[model samples]
Target: MMGGKGNSVFSLSPNPNHLCISMEDGSQSSEQLVVDDDDDDLPPIDDTPDLDIDLEEEEEEETRRDEKCFMAPPAPGMEFDSYDDAYSFYNSYARALGFAIRVKSSWTKRNSKEKRGAVLCCNCQGFKLLKDASSRRKDTRTGCQAMIRLRLIQFDRWKVDQVYLHHNHSFDPHRAHKKSSSAATKTTLPQPPLHVQVRTIRLYRTLSLHTPPTHPLFQSSRRLELRGGFRALQDFFFQIQLTSPNFLYLMDLADDGCLRNVFWIDARARAAYSHFGDLLLFDTTCLSNAYDLPLVAFVGINHHGDTILLGCGLVADQSFDTYVWLFRAWLTCMLGRPPQTFITQQCKAMRTAVSEVFPRAHHRLSLTHVLHNIFHSVVQLQDSDLFRMALNRVVYGCLKVEEFEIAWEEMIIRFGLTNNETIQHMFQDRELWAPVYLKDTFLAGALTFPLGNVAAPFIFSGYVHENTSLREFLEGYESFLDQKYTREALCDSESLKSIPELKTTHPYESQMAKVFTMQIFRRFQDEVSAMSSCFGVTQVHSNGSASSYVVKEREGEKVRDFEVIYETSAAAQVRCFCVCGGFSFNGYQCRHVLLLLSHNGLQEVPPQYILQRWRKDVKRLYVAEFGSGRVDIMNPDQWYEHLHRRAMQVVEQGMRSKEHCRAAWEAFKECANKVQFVTEKPS
Candidate 1:
């Protein structure tokens, strides 16, 4: 076994009988010797008591040192001794750690009576560590560290921040081993790990008392569950929904958790909401009632005949052009076709619009309108009873062209209206309108009946007769009224006293009868003039030539004197030059030939004139030929019957025999070819 020194420095020899010894400082040489038998039998010594005593002394020394370090009293406003002191220190320390702290007065203790009560616990304030820091700042003392925990509490409650101090102690190699003391310097501590639990603060504030939260006006359920801080409420009112007057009312009831000013709602938002169907109805009446201008309403009728409001727009000043485009677009959408028949008052604009959009459709002037215009014009002319009778004779009843001519002449003579240019123009286009009156159905009798006298002037310019029994009876009845109520007696009546003086007739008791008779004739002349002048005739030549003709008044009636000269070789080429200027000045030719022939050239009519005078259908003569060397001895009806029977026999024979069928087929093909050839030939 080695001595203590040798054993501590190196391992002993494994021989139990050998002994090795070395000096502690290694100055002496190591020596090895045989072990004594007597030493081997000696017992092992126990050193447990000695070791326990040494450890007890060491612990005692450490306890004394710790007590000495903690003995110093904390400075004012500093906490060092107790947990309360530590908590107070922590309150400021946590704020320095970037944790926002809120203190409540009552939160410090749970019971009012208890002085050493447990600190009311709550969530700690949170802080985030900076990404980069200097080495000095990042030192153990300088780094971020949690010093306190903040607790949230209800109003009127106290708040507290708890803190813990962290200290650093280590031996330095450079310092001498001596008993010494240095004043401690305060240093920033490292930040603690962030708290895992986070609590969001919510607040409520009353915006307005008038628009309360519980008010029925704030009926939108969507407005109730909004969540956010004061800033969020601001965004909701101003940025999101926009605070209109309506919305402002709703906002007034909102209790803001995070108090913030409400935002204004713009006019744009009001306009937007106003148009959402049932939300608000806009008033556009001002646009409609601005002027006395005429507006055409375009209404669309569905297949069910229900009208749909299409649109309303300003009417153009030029009515005709505007209506043309408007009605064209309207009809296209409604009926899928332009209107074929248009009935309207005698408005020039309406007429033009009809011609532009529905040229092919028949356009009829309202009889009521025509009559009204005629009545006004008739009031301007003054005539007598004969003229009145002649005018009535032509208007109320349908008569032949010759009768119309005779009545017209008589009316002009009686009225002294023969030299009136306006009256002459009225008769200028009689041919074009004569068909309308002669065929009563043309106007559905609206222009010819009970209101004949009233509607005549407006409808046509022509003669009317008073020969009917009804007219005669009315005349007798009127005479009886005149006898029973003389002018003086009529003037004295209370009903007549209030009546305004007649425009055309003076209130002369002596001339009342004459004025009444003159009024009738004036009305008759007006009707005749209006109807005759309504249309102007333009002659259309076969070769595409056109010319306008106006009726000329000779004395007081329209008259035409013209001679038609034909080429001897080409009688078809005829020229007509009327002393009335043909269609150049007036719209139509007058009948001077009838006057001349009836008065001076009777039974000596020219051949060319006779041919021209024939009716349109009678002027043409057809010559028929059967075939080469075959006379056309067949009567049209008999030949047609024979052809039909032959066709039936041919069909029967074709079905019975194949030879006949083949022959029939050949004949049919020949007939088809012949027909094709004929169709291809020039006229």
Candidate 2:
């Protein structure tokens, strides 16, 4: 028997004197196969079991040929209970041998109540590379007629009926058995160790800070691509959605079928925004990611005077339409109640979007961004230091519009920047930037203390410089959020530890110390301490139900005063007009009002004065699930306001002494749960 082409034999010749044995009734006959040729290497006929062997010499030679050539079993004809089993057996054998096998044809008759089926065949080694890169290599079979066929057996079982063992090309079993870098072998990528994954997560975050998302590092980085590309990153989003009920993700595709924009916000962030969103800070200065898309963050000041990241968006452009679309999407998520005040860089697109989406909202420019421009404007001046100091004093010290006008004119004249384009532009947008014009707005002086400059919730300009893929940027975003949460937690812990001693005789101050967080309590303490310096001169109004008082603050260095109007109603709510606009901007009662309240016969802080965002338990987001969609218990801002009212009533009645309404608190909570359950249930 001569082997064909590279020791690959096609047939084995039978000996002339060899006896042909056949099976009868599914059982082999007890017949002996006689060896024809005088081949001493062949096993004796009587030694062989009762089996079909046309020629002993040929059979022995076949076995020797396989061993000599080191050929693995070629796609064995094995019995299987189903097509899947047959494929598994054949593929496993083929894999063990070098080279690949694929199905050429298959048939199935399952609908006819017959268990007849087969699937994929050997396409692995059939295709050849084309001369041209563009040319198709659809069929380049090696004419190796090594095929396996399966037929239906009893009880839905499939039995291998035919398996040919002829190949035109040779194979190396050892090399094929080992894993290969070919795409065919990589059906599933191996997962890295948990520790390695954690370390990679850190590396990904660090690299993201220095490179844009479209950089080569993000595309080819092994550590970042271990999760199997963009699909894996999408899976992460799905996982978040599955685990978190309040998480929302929205994406829009461009005309070329690419991602145009995306916005995501978790439940906690949304809840925080709903409570502290009255004074919003929108910043679009951070342009990051591979697409060079701007990172827009909506930030708000919490009760602690700390910045709270509300939500983030990535847009293709800073156009009015794009900003409008982004704001509308955010509004939909936040239940359509816009923030009362918006602090942002003086971008025309951003300004237009705010005016359209939140017509009632007070759109103010960020003082930080304004000062940035002022510095740039003064950079070319002869005496820049004098100009900067003059600018700061003009912007910071003015408490009235008239004072601001005088200071602004003097600074520009003194510094010879009267014709400056930057200053002129700022003057044109004076109401948007100057605190004097925006003193009535409840922004909590956020313009002075910009929230946009604080801890960013997602990928911001400071954290991303390398070009990165969308998937990698998103993964890095998760890590960034984790870091922010860790920082916030640490800050909260440190603030709690450093809570000042309640060194005041006012009962309301002591009550506030218990209800408010340490940071807010300390802040309110200043007002309590200053109450001693404020002298009230009350005058009865014609209405008779209300009285106006001149609260004059006569400190040794600073002399300031405010008008406090006390409504002589059972509710006991006081209104104050102060230069600082602390109550209007910060959501907390100003010092003058606090002094007036303390001076009055009031026993506790008015419920209306206590903002929920300052409460110790502001993190508890009240989410309610309903059918396919869900709604926040505080979906409508009024709901939160109503809850605050009830809470204040409870606190007012409970804080009569050290022993308050413990039972009443429990009852109120229980009633709230029951009401929520009923309201949330489908009608």
Count of residue pairs whose backbone atoms collide, per candidate: 50, 26
Superposed Cα deviation of residue 143, candidate 1 (Å): 48
TM-score of each: 0.21, 0.54
**Stretch of 10 with least lDDT, candidate 1:** 1-10
lDDT of each: 0.29, 0.54
Q: What is the C-alpha RMSD of each candidate to the true structure, in Å?
A: 47.2, 22.5
Highest lDDT model number: 2
| 262-325: candidate 1 lDDT, tens digit per residue | 1122222222221111111111121123322122232221111112123222232333333443
Span of ten consecutive residues with least summed lDDT in model 2: 1-10
lDDT of 2 at 605: 77
lDDT of 1 at 228: 17
